[model samples]
Target chain A: MVAQAAWVVLLLLGIGLLLQNDLGSRLALFGIQPDLLLGALVLLARRMGPLTGLAVGFAAGLMQDGLMPDHVGLNAWLLMTAGFLCGHARESIFWESSVASALIVFLAALLHNFAQGVLASGFNLNASLQLLLRSGLPSAAYTAVFVTFVAYAVPRVLRGRD
Target chain B: MPAPRTPSDRAAFLLYIFLSFVALGVWLSPFPSPRAWVTGAASALYLPFRAVSKGVENLLGLVVEREGLLTEAAELRRARIGIQELREENQRLRDQMDFARRDSLHLVPAWVLAKRSDRLGSRVLINRGQLDGVRIGFPVIGREGLVGRVDALEGHLSRVRLLTDRASAVSASIDRSHVDGIVEGDPVEGLRMRFVSYSADVKPGDVVVTSGLGGSFPPGLPVGRVRRLGLESGGLLRRIEIEPAELPERVQDVFVLAAGDSSRGWGFLWARPVAPTDSLAESVRTPRVEP
Candidate 1:
């Protein structure tokens, strides 16, 4: 359990660093990059339980928020909710299917962006709903593709190692 | 599929909500918070990565956007030459117009250090500051035209609020029609020349320039070209949207015009006789500063 926790923390830090480095901008498709951190959170929540999801989500989101100029708590709020939902869903949902994994990632990303738009409006951050959707939808699709690939390959790799 | 929510889930949700609120509160507060330090540190840690990424992007740009970049570079060179010619021409015009020598004007060159990340706010930081004689309210001009005004000053850096900023307003006139209006910046539309008389003959492609009425910007400096014209809801004033002469993305260096004779540029206008068909009332037109 301790080893798993350390791995999760390491993953969060690595993702945080990568996102902040702006590789996302280079990889942007239609002015949207895959939300790698969000994918990691969703995957973690699916693998772990609700409690671990909540804690990891908060930490990862806070790290992201720390790098941003404004809207410090906005990501934390969104990611926490995402993690919680995914964590709870893990109990009943089977992640063995790659299609389901992609769907989950897409839903998570959509929720994250929609929540971002709502929060931006509340904070008067000048991010319009139209702008949010324009960037968000593509980002969701991109992240979903990556998550699907990971979902397919990771299990096989682990089984091979065993 | 619905998953059963346990007591633990409820408690965790509440805790997360509470933490998020605390963070929100800290961000909203005007006072300094530890969160700023944390964010700054995280950003600092990413600086080397950013530098590397920038280098890689530039390399890729050379490969992919070679033609576009070359075209832009050529355009910039042409613009620089044109600006130099305009500067020399303006010097001669200034000598002819301001024969009385009442105003002292000089340009100070400054490098654009950084651009503000906030999409809503159009501001930039320059390297020149108080030590370099840069001050608040001084006009900053790019190679193309009017860029912005110095909004704030520090020991070695200054903030310039661009003409496209919502708070910025400039007294301007249509070059051909001489219709006077107050130009204001809009985030959505580039710049809007407001409160022109309804009867004023303004149209698309008309050149707009500073009238030098407000003392913030000098007279005769090009601000933008009229892109579109419309009548306001009140119908009393005509609304004119303008495309800013200076493209913010291409602006690298700017000259701060400090204490200049802006009024004297209207000498040519004064020398020309008015046509009778141009029935623009004197009250509607702003008075030109004369020597």
Candidate 2:
């Protein structure tokens, strides 16, 4: 359990660093970058179930929130909810198939990006729709594509390695 | 590997939701919270990583553009020589006109880290912070003119709010007319100057500079030029539009003016009088925008 916790922390920190650096800038699509931390949360929840997923997602989101200019808890709340939902889905939906895993990642990315736009709007109902269409939509699509690619490819590579 | 929906899961979910609301409340709170410390610590940790990544990128770019860099170096060398001569001439003129030298100003130079992606406001992250004597409200200036002021500060990183941000407002005066007004930003519609009396003479092409009335910014710093002038609907003050002198997009390095330094007000611009042949001088001498 301690080893797993350590791995989660390391992965979160690594992703946070990657997101802020030039490596992240090089990967930007229409000024939107992939949310690797969010992807990690989805994968963890899908594999480890809801309880562990919630904890890891919250921790990772907190780190991400700290790095970005937005409110500190915004990412934490969104990612935690995402983790819970993904973890709960594991019981009924088998994400063992790469396509299913990719779909989960795509939906999570879209939801996460949309929530981020909502939070940035400070819950202003007037600006919410505009923010969603402007920043949220493009970011969601870009991140989903990246996350889906990772989800599909990583499993294939790992299986080949085994 | 579906974990069963046990009582523990329900309990954890309830607790997590409560915590999430608390976090949301903290975010909405009017007062500063402890989250700033977390941000500062995380930024400090990420600094080394950022530096290494930037260095690697620079190295890669150098390898890819060796020939281009060589050509750029030759151009830079000629530009440097021209700049050196211009600097000497400027110094000579300043001395000739008895303009106050900014010897007391302690400027902290910093490199831009990353520009913020927020659409609501314009901001850029810089590699200077509390450790470098950078504080909120300090004026950030580029080689050309005013860039912005530091909005948020961390241990080793700071966010500078550009003058083009909608939230930005600066007290300014026309250099030729000596008419005072407030210059404000509209992120979408560009910058606009307000509160000039209808009787005051303002025309397109008039230079605007800081008035130092608010104490937030020093006096006589070049802000922008008047793009257009129009009467306010109220028939009291004229609404003057301005174009910013410095473009934030092209800025790589900026100097943060230290706080509580009143000795660094811009006096260099006063060294030369506005030319009598200037068209705005006639407009300033005679009010053009009638009530």
Chain B TM-score of model 2, please? 0.53
**B188-262 in candidate 1: lDDT tens per residue?**
787999989889999899999999887667688899999998889999988899999986667789988753343
Clashing pairs in model 1, backbone N/Cα/C closer than 3 A: none
What C-alpha lDDT values do all the predictions have? Answer: 0.74, 0.72
Docking class of 2: incorrect
For every model shown, the clashing-pair count is: 0, 0
Tens-digit per-residue lDDT, A1-162, candidate 2? 999877756655655557634445678877776667777678878888777677766766666667874788777778888887898888777787767776788788777777776677766755876766776666666666677677677778899999
RMSD of each: 33.6, 35.6
Q: Model 2, retained fraction of real contacts? A: 0.38
Model 1, total clashes? 0
- Local accuracy of candidate 2 as per-residue lDDT tens digits, B1-291: 233468977766775777677656556656665478657766776666667767887998888799788889999999999999999999899876553334234578998998752446767888887567665567788887788887666667777878888788888999998999888876765678998998898889999998988667888888889998888898898988888887767878988876332233323321122223222224336533311
Candidate 1, chain A: TM-score against the reference? 0.81
lDDT of 1 by residue, A10-81 (tens): 555655557634656666776678887788788888998666676777766666777775677667667777
lDDT of 1: 0.74
